[model samples]
Target: MLAFLVAGVILGVLARVLHHEPDDPSPVLTVVLGAVAAAAAGGVMNLFLGDDLTALTPWSFTSSCIVTFVLLGLLEGVWWRRP
Candidate 1:
């Protein structure tokens, strides 16, 4: 849990820093959001993986961040941006 929180904070900060004209949420909010995301990711895995792998692990944390970032980017239409 603590590891997940720490990882989430780090991920959120990096997301903010890399935002290119980024309007990031407040640091505290970012952490909270990341935590929520991490939990959701774990829940998804639990729902899907099913009796095979343990739900929340280092891989889960990493996957949670990747999924969060990708989803955020997708919603922002990164690929459709004008360069």
Candidate 2:
């Protein structure tokens, strides 16, 4: 869980840095989304890997980062479409 959150935060910051715009959402939301994405991805990975809940693995971290970035992209798209 801790590792997931940590990775999430880092990925969130990365997303924020990469998605720079004149009118973007708050960093808090991005960070929160990253955290949630990481946790959800981690859970899915645990189910498939048959590992303990808190266990951290390279695959889990990679998946978490990927999911987080994907989610951030979705979020930016949604914001782009919003009036």
Candidate 3:
């Protein structure tokens, strides 16, 4: 849980830094999205790796950050669509 939160915050900050613009989504929203993505990633990884979801292992942390970044990028795309 703590690891997820930390990863989420890091992911959120990075997303904001990369996509900082006048019309970008709010930081709070991004942070929440990142947190959720991290949790989902942990769940999926645990499903495949048979690891404890609550355990803050390196694999879990890395996987969570990867998923969170990917999810945030996708969400940003949708949010910034021209059409």
Candidate 4:
């Protein structure tokens, strides 16, 4: 959980930095949302993949990251579409 939260925050910060748009969401908000999304994704992955929740395996980490990135991208797209 701790590792996932850290990873989420890092990814969120990286995403925010890379975008650097005036209309983008706040950094804190992005990090919080990213952490939540990552935790949710980790839970789902553990449920479906039969992996231990507390174990930080490579596969689990990779899947969580992939899910987080995809989710963030979708969120950005939705925000972009809003008028």
Q: Which candidate is the best by lDDT?
A: 2
Better of 2 and 3 by TM-score: 2
- All candidates' TM-scores? 0.57, 0.86, 0.84, 0.84
Residue 53 deviation, candidate 2, in Å?
1.3
Against the true structure, candidate 2 reaches a TM-score of: 0.86
Clashes of each: 0, 0, 0, 0
- Candidate 2 displacement at residue 20 in angstroms: 1.8
Q: Model 1: runs farther than 4 Å from truth?
A: 20-23, 51-55, 71-83
> Model 3 — which ten-residue stretch has the worst lDDT?
74-83
lDDT of 4 by residue, 1-83 (tens): 77777788887887777776777777887788778777777767776788777567676677778878877776665765458
- Candidate 4 structure lDDT: 0.75
Which candidate achieves the best TM-score against the true structure?
2
Clashes of 2: 0
Better of 1 and 2 by TM-score: 2
Sorted by lDDT, highest first, which candidate order results?
A: 2, 3, 4, 1
Off by over 4 Å in 4: none
**What does candidate 1's lDDT look like per residue over 1-83, in tens digits?**
55555666676666656664554445565556666666566556655656233346656666777766664455334543556
Higher-scoring candidate on TM-score, 2 or 4? 2
